[model samples]
Target chain A: MLKKRIIPCLDVKNGRVVKGTNFVDIRDAGDPVDLAKHYDKAGADELVFLDITASHEKRDTMIEVVRQTARDVYIPFTVGGGIKSIDDMRAILRAGADKVSINTPAILNKELITKGAEIFGSQCIVVAIDAKAKGDGSYEAYINGGRVNTGIDVFSWAKEVEKLGAGEILLTSMDRDGTKDGYDLELTRQVSELVGIPVIASGGVGSLEHLYEGLVKGKASAALAASIFHYGTYSVAEAKRFLIDKGVKVRW
Target chain B: MIGIIDYGRGNMSSVEAALKKSGYKFVNTDDIGILATCDGYILPGVGAFKDGMEDLAKRGLDAFLKEVAKTDKPVLGICLGMQLLFDYGEEHGGAKGLGLIKGQVKKLTTSFKIPHMGWNSLELKRESSLLSGIVSGDDFYFVHSFKVVPDDDSVVVATCEYGEEIVAVVECGKIFGAQFHPEKSSDKGLKIINNFGKLVERC
Candidate 1:
């Protein structure tokens, strides 16, 4: 069976990770390259970089970060945030990113998904959705890191993105993000069951059991977490062992 | 030098970077003449099989690859490049492939999911120069919706199960292919690229 993936997302601002890591394993744990190397060694299936710094001037620095990370870390890492145009996607990809995740631009101009898939192939385009539960048994898609509401239905939007040529969907639940409670299983399962493509469950991953829930209960293809792994709450190898111990197949 | 064929698809730079990182000299070019001179050829691609095949034919690379196959001097394909090594593919309408390996690329009919993306463990079926020094069940990165089913299972170097067995690596004579992107698969994956480099060196 296809192994479930555990990806550690690094939030970057101005070519540097926004938060510093206090890991004893990594010499410079806060450094994106060093942190990525640590995760690679820890058995992370993949890594994702979100460019919180969307400034045009900072683009070069972001590219440099990607290049350096690519040189040091061999596992594929995705670059998200601030990627607006195909040229941006091409630049980062050339700089050595295996895939590019589009959230804001994909919602603003849905054609970007189809066009990007047409030009670079669907495998390279990952559509990320930040959704917050409506309390009315529905969820609304958000952009700008769950700040702005797009008023789009999450289920319908996921299907649209899949139809628009997106190879995978990164579904983040704003309701559970940073809460450390667990994934929004209802939302993840709801959206995942609707899309034919793979869905990566993100936000509020606080424990190994939570990741398993994201997979077994939420029906996510992969589970993505941030702080827990970043701050050394648990190593990726530990997460894999935990998952496999519970019958979830994970690549070690 | 290993010749990396530019079929107007696939991340040529990633493969180039992987080659450079592994301390191998390679030329990324589409010129059939240049490709023929190299000791080995890598058909790298990323796109629908129909478009890739059409582009290869348009650029006269189809004939070039066939000619190189006859020489049997280590020809390898990565991901979509690997799928294109077969007889035909059923993506975005059925399309003909290079026929270097007898098979058809069809959509993965697993109830699990499509695009079978991310990391998966290799279940080695047999030994091959491409997977040299790699253990039987090492992990490698994979991102694809369609998989190649070789007519002759003997060519299957390894298999990765995703609801069903997926052809992970294939080798027959000097021709080779990997459904996973070895370039993006980290150390073991790069070791596979290094193995190919050794194959080129042997050639």
Candidate 2:
């Protein structure tokens, strides 16, 4: 059976993790390597380090951070944020990142996704979509930390991205993000049903039941949370234990 | 000294860095003479089976590996390198392996996921020095779609359930192959590497 994964996402800037209430008013979390090691020790299925400011910076400092983290922690680590070209993907992978998540660049140039999959194999590329629920009950694709709206339908875009060779979809719900109400179950289920690749539910998750809901109801292969994990509200081992008690096959 | 085969796959620096940090003397080379002189060999590989096999053939390391296997010298294959130890693989149509072990690498047919990329626990099946300090149910990092099905199941050291029981580690005398990358696994991963380093000293 495929075990459901619990991932803690870290947004790194200038080598330190910074968290925000709603992707703004950033506060320093800690060193990425330290946080990553802690997560690894806590039994996190995987760790995601997003260089939120990769495009603004001239050099990719995340590579060094990833290298350091990979040395210290044994779990798989994924790097996202800027990742525009194949060279960026190559450099990160060479730096010891197990997977590379692409967001803005993939939406801008669809070919980059296919190229990444072709050169590095589909398993290495992850397409992260920041989706915002609209007033009409539809979702729109947002990029640059939800600052820019691509005006593309989230469901259509996810299907297209899958067709473009995205190994997995890291779907983030901007509306429910940091709300802690729980994941947008309906949105997650819709996307997961549309795409064949593994869907990692991101953005809104408050408790162990939310993670279970993401896996069981939302049909997400994994659940990623930031505030809950970053604030130490719940450890991955505890979450996995709860999920296991609920009969969810989690890697415990 | 440990010899880590470098055939332009991916991430040889980190592997070398890990070995060096662990206080083990090692070199990354494809040259047969230099590789053969090493106390033990660590075959590390990434990317497709076809490309990896082509690079091994181009460097004439294929026959040399067969000779090393015959000597029963300690050799460890990580990730794609581990896949190459089998008799054949179904990646990119089909490719020939090093034939050190009697097995074939086939794509995972699980509806769960394709890559199976993340941290998963191992279920130890047999006892061996390669897993001396490792415990059953210890999680290890895995990132591959294809797994080895050994002709002789007794050779399997550990297995991980991913829709099916996939062979995680296989040991036949001095030759060992881990489908997961120990250099990339973390603490348990380092312990496995340390065990291999000790094997080098014994050799």
* Top candidate (TM-score): 1
All candidates: TM-score: 0.94, 0.92
Q: Which stretches of candidate 1 lie over 4 Å from their true place?
A: A19-29, A55-57
Model 1, span B58-82: residue lDDT tens: 8899998898889859988999899
Best by lDDT: 1
Local distance difference test, per candidate? 0.86, 0.86
Candidate 1 residue B63 C-alpha distance from true site, Å: 1.9
> Which residue pairs collide in model 2, if any?
A1-B163, A74-B185, A74-B186
Instruction: Compose the digit string of candidate 2's lDDT tens values, residues A6-100.
Output: 88999899998987666878888898999988987787878899898888885457888988886777677789988889999998988888789
TM-score of 2: 0.92
